[model samples]
Target: MQPGIIRLSGLFFLLIGSALVLSSFGRVDNAEKDFSPEQPCEWVFKISDKSLALFQDKLLDLAFETASSIPMNPHIKDRSRAQETVVLACLHLDCPKRALRYMDQIVDWRRGSCYADLAFYFARRDCIDDARRCIQIASQISESAEDWRRDRIRVKIAQTYVWLGQNQQVDEFEAGVVDSELGKVARVKAMRSDADAFHEQMQVLETRMESGNFDIMNNTLQAYTELFHRFYSDVQKRSLVEEKIKTAWNGMPISTRIERLTDLAEFALEHSDSDKALALVNDAQSLIDGRQWPLEHFIPMMGKLAALRFRTGDRQKARSEADAARVLFHAQKDTIVNIWKAGTLRPLAQAYQTMEDPDAALSLYKQALAAGIENPNSRPRAEDLTATCLSMALYAVEPDDDLWGQAHRIYQGLDHPW
Candidate 1:
């Protein structure tokens, strides 16, 4: 998966759902005293509206230019998915025309899904004609797709229709689905339609897994995570979601649970629930202290956990965690494969920045940029560099003159799609 896209996906969901819920509490500006730049909405809100628009334009331009550079090949699909992420982001930012330029650059089922998402975007704004037009185009693309790809696209179309409250259209696409992957697609369609049914099925699945039935599918757990957050405000629903997630992770490796807990902590922080975020971070820390993991997993998790701890107001421990991660990074720097060096360093840099160590952060950022350039695979190399640039831009990390020149030189030389 593209790290660049992973970072952007959270923003896409926040723009569509969380922003509205948060507005009822008050604009992000009102909560400035309570939050730091660690919050995504707050960070973007800190920027002037004019600057935000200019940043959006620059991001889309980068995405489009990257997409244009990709050569048509079997592997091009993976590269183009990063551009697809930017298209969704552009639509959320009210840059629909720019989004369309990158839409056609995506391949197969993904392109159809992008149009379906665009249709949803338009539908929410009451642009019914444009919504329907995009849905028709998405449906046509789905029809031309073969086998499992067709069902995948249809699932996106059906979900979009659900959002549009077009039940007839939803059912039409649902009926056309052919079972694949042991009817997982059918289960996804059913689960999406009924929350109560999803809850009941999750209970049953959790029971079976605890009793030594085979592991739950990763996608099933992912679907649960996505759906459960919508009901996070409901006390009983929140309990159920927490139980399911913990149970699902029970038998996985400790590192996996640590990672998930850290992610849950970050998600809680996004919603401004500091108490819950701190609890999740404590749980992850317990796991971290219980065993020794390979440096690969341990270092990144420490970097992330450190930033989260700082956000939760545990400044002393956060500083210690960051220092420990920095130490481990130096010790293991030569042993880490070139492709993953930037991935590891980026988070460490963020942790330092969060801790108000700009000099250290700046040094690490430069090291990450250099490491990103070491990857032989052009596409992934570009992705690593793009992810670093995105983290700097979105989090308000200011580069000094020397680092700015270095980044500009690297970006100008990038010719492959990220």
Candidate 2:
């Protein structure tokens, strides 16, 4: 061979060797062993360092081993895909440093895939700065991405903002996507409604403060009470809302005590904090028992006591309390109280079932179903209880019966599958 050609061949071999070495290092650092019979050489990657840590703490090695069963293309030319895979592997290893390094590589790609994945990764890490950067890049990429991808990116961005305590930003982001290319009509509508209601309530409270209209203050408090009830499942957000309500309530006259207790009990119930609900109910009961309050106060306290008893697995006591509450509600002609009273019967039936009294359970279940049918909207939860009771009754009679089949059929008959 000519001298120049020989030199060129040597240079080419050197370059190829360097590339091969780099690629191999990348693979070894991210490589996961797969012992599954079905998918050898495949790597399963996680994307959250905290989640990986949790899995490790739980000693869920089997899950990690199973995830490693997926295969990768050893010679794939896409460096971005390789980086993504590495990021996932590092996450699975609970190595945030390595995961962030690969995430940077993907961010350099500046594509929709990179933006979406990196946004979620940063959000999971609670790195708000990186998450915001990812959101910006994602927004730019979203202009050219598919509609579904854009919608997903928008929701992720909103969620990230929510995590960062930028709730107003979440509102703005959701509003922009409401009727836009994103197809999240229902979520957008609900969020917008909540934001609007919260704002309106704030305004009403401000106005009442200026005008000294205590009657209007009642309306403002009620609005917030309802709003908190509607969104109480979210602990952090509910805490913030409750703080605001308490601050406002404390500034008002002592005459608002009963209403405040009522609202707090309702909030506790909505959040599934049965202990808190019971405590608030007891506070109300003290006023009634001391003759400082009326029979109406005792009514709500009795209902809450029944609910607390049922939650604590004391169904017999719960049933007695609920029966008394039912009579009081009927005498007062309070539909809301009646609804709560009817709610107790279903759980009472479950208590009977637990006590091995199927006959009593069946009778209570039938009564609950009849009450529910008469006031469908008021007892919206009764259908599920009815189905449960029917299924349990069938099982107690004959363990081999097709109770599940019947239950499935009943679920299908319902307009909404709740």
lDDT of each: 0.60, 0.44
How do the residues 1-418 of candidate 1 rate in per-residue lDDT, one tens digit apiece? 1121222333342222111111112222211111111321111111122235454355446545644354435344544455555576665455555566567656546677677766666665566777777778778777666666667667666765665667787787767464332223323343344556666656654553454322234334444454455555666866777778787765677765765576567667766788888999999889888686666557767887898899988889999989988888898788877766777777788788888998998898888888877865556555555556555544446777787677667667766433
Mind giving the per-residue lDDT tens digits that candidate 2 earns over 194-312?
65365554464445435445644554555455555556675665566566666666557543655456556755754678777667656645544555433333543454445555654
lDDT of 2 at 115: 51
The regions of model 1 sitting more than 4 angstroms off are 1-56, 88-97, 107-109, 121-130, 171-216, 226-228, 253-256, 352-362, 398-400, 412-418
For candidate 2, the lDDT comes to: 0.44
Candidate 1 RMSD to the correct structure: 11.7
lDDT of 2 at 304: 45
| lDDT of model 1 at position 173 | 78
Cα-based TM-score, every candidate: 0.71, 0.31
Candidate of highest TM-score: 1
